[model samples]
Target: MKTLNDLLQLGDPRLYEVCEPVQENELPMVKEWVADLHNVMEEIRAKYKFGRGIAAPQLGIMKRLIYLNLNTPSGSVPYIIINPVFENLSEELFELWDDCMSFPNLLVKVKRHQSLTIKYLDENWQPKVWKVEGAISELLQHEFDHLEGILCTMRAIDNQSFKWRPTPDSN
Candidate 1:
């Protein structure tokens, strides 16, 4: 029954604070956070039918953890990125419209690297590295920014590029 209200909104200052690296003992709570994230995503998907990922901070848990339920051409793949850090970024950049659960009704036009290398710990606390491009790469950047207390609005290319989310009828 949990929905987007479970997520922290844009005005919450806690979203601006950098999250701490999750520790071993925090697994129990981390799991709960992950569950909450999944539930929120599921609720959103059932209604909106689209989502990619979410960060712990979005749930008001200031830990360096993120969950992704990606819909790939092959199939759906779930991910848990703990304490993620970008290893490299491509020189190429592209502009795209981005949205966030924190500010669900707004879309921001932002420029991001076309591709990048990222390293992080999995849900099991195991190390993981990925060379991501296109939508996945963009998705990671958006979620990662939350760990640094940055929002898509902050990443917008210009004041004019920011916009309100469109109604389904408009789409």
Candidate 2:
């Protein structure tokens, strides 16, 4: 099982390359990849205390896969999104301090669509569509950008938009 140590950090050339879509034949192997992503995300959350989603490329898998474990009012819901395609994006936009497992110590202030519709294959390789807004929308956009070899730092509002997360000792 892969741990947080296995996560590719910012500036890794592999993270800058566009990921390939998960092929139908690879569905059987996707489970292992998802497991690795989940383990790494969970390890990140345990150590850094913040992690909502992770993309396969972050693990050097170079495949179009994202694992999200969102905490909803009802409970923590996990999703394995494969080969996601954007169907729509709302004109309304919002900005937030986005953090990533790739660079856990820094935060990048960036703009993101307030809402988006996406079509993707689920863990079972079944097609599904979802319309998400607010935090979920922002999270999805962040992960989707990874598939295109884009990082939040590249989308920073400006040079001044970069900042380091306060360490526990500092806080």
Highest TM-score scorer: 2
- Put down candidate 2 lDDT per residue, 1-171, tens digits, no spaces: 888788999999998899999999999999999999999988998889999999999999999999999998999999999999997799999999999999999999999999999999999999999999999999999999999999999999998999999986784
Q: How well does each candidate superpose onto the true structure, as a TM-score?
A: 0.93, 0.97
Question: In the order shown, what is each candidate's alpha-carbon RMSD?
Answer: 1.6, 1.0
In the range 68-146, model 1's lDDT, one tens digit per residue, is 9988799989999999999679989999989887777788899999999999988787899999998899999999999
- TM-score, structure 1 vs. true: 0.93
Off by over 4 Å in 1: none
Off by over 4 Å in 2: none
Residue 133 lDDT (model 1): 95
* Model 1: colliding residue pairs: none
* Model 1 per-residue lDDT at 26: 83
Clashes of 1: 0
